[model samples]
Target: MHEPDYGVAGRTAIVTGASQGIGKAIAETLAASGANVVICSRAQERVDPVAEAIDDECEGTALAVECNVREREQVDALVDATVAEFGGVDVLVNNAGGEFVAPFEDISPNGWNAIVDLNLNGTVHCTQVAGEVMRENGGGSIVNLSSVNGQHAAPGESHYGAAKAAIIRLTETLAVEWAPHGIRVNCVAPGLIQTPGVAETLGIDSEQMPEREEVDRRIGHGEEIADLVQFLVSPAASFVTGETVTAKGVPKPGNSMSEGLGLE
Candidate 1:
């Protein structure tokens, strides 16, 4: 029997915020699968080592670039650098975004704009710049990272939810607009994921959670999201676009109940 091909080999992919967590996993996963990966974060120091490590361990190449997606100049440089290194980009993952917990009334204009700039505007910058290259190259895939809060309520994270929700709409619109260019745009909405940052924020150790049988029922790992992203960008999902894939694991029976509605 012939082995199934995910069809990412020899492709060049750029993943933003790839210094850690879901972004890191996606970069490494793509590199390991024979796709030349360009990993970027706001700091060169954080992403350089990851690039070197991928070079040592993976079958494909890894390049590290420092970029703040909110800035169009830096994002342009990142795309140009990737294109210079690997000819043209075949996949792009907009995975850099953040938000602070605060009530709607407490959210300052600057704070709200900051979150929206990072989550929504940032995606716009990267997609537009990268889409141009992909359009010229005949085809490519673009994946935007969203959050489950965008679908449900996030009391203390209203700004975050709003920004993520905008990303969903942007993904759908871009998918249709770019279809003629063969550029597929999609979004991934991940619920609770077990990562160091999340663990620290929640005052729980994810390292220890796996030792318990509850691991199966607990939050997912960054690798799981990476797996979904891998599929979405690969040939396995050629027919998929303008879609939001939620990787939140199984929902509890009472999640929709009033008593179960609570913020993280």
Candidate 2:
């Protein structure tokens, strides 16, 4: 096994959306670093391969559960399965989410509710349930995946942006509320990265190659994001809580577009 800052050896973790992309990477990394990990996505078959692959390579135990976090029953079972297998959860990564980009007027109630339920309500369910277990077993850490879009609104993702923004506030609130119980909550708000979902949304082609290249050349990677997450959950970050750690390439300029374009 690889040496990791997190003496994650034997620490049990539950990472949502762990079938692919950023969540997959986080699960794999955590397992490699010595944490017994429980990972879930909505698909059992799809996630089973990831769990098997992780178990083969990492020192920690891995389990893949098919859980649609939007459903409370499944989310409860996901947590229950983890506790049954690993004894308890030490880290919870709320990484399962989806987005629907459309003109605000064109967004149907279904579209809006789905995003709200998965991103915001899903986080709520997982954190609430997992916090209860962690509180009983002893306190733990929660790392939520928000987005930079939450901080900077864009053309067609009003719903996604709103949900992500709420995650930031929710992180802060959970930190305060759960602190007394010995749990720490933090959020990671990432800028553009070359993930499948992101690429698909951008109509990724030669025209978008420059943007993708720029992000690769400047922004973060799934592994790097996982590294930060490892730190935030480890004792190294005991002092850090209720903070929205932005993982953008540049320090946010803090200036409005109007100011930059001289429209002000």
Highest-TM-score candidate: 1
Task: Find the 10 residues in a row with the least total lDDT in model 2.
Answer: 209-218
Backbone clashes counted, model 1: 0
Prediction-by-prediction clash tally: 0, 0
lDDT of each: 0.89, 0.86
TM-score of each: 0.90, 0.89
lDDT of 1 at 53: 97
Best by lDDT: 1
**lDDT assessment of candidate 1:** 0.89
In candidate 1, list every pair of residues with a backbone clash.
none
lDDT of 2 at 99: 82
Output the lDDT of residue 84, model 1: 93
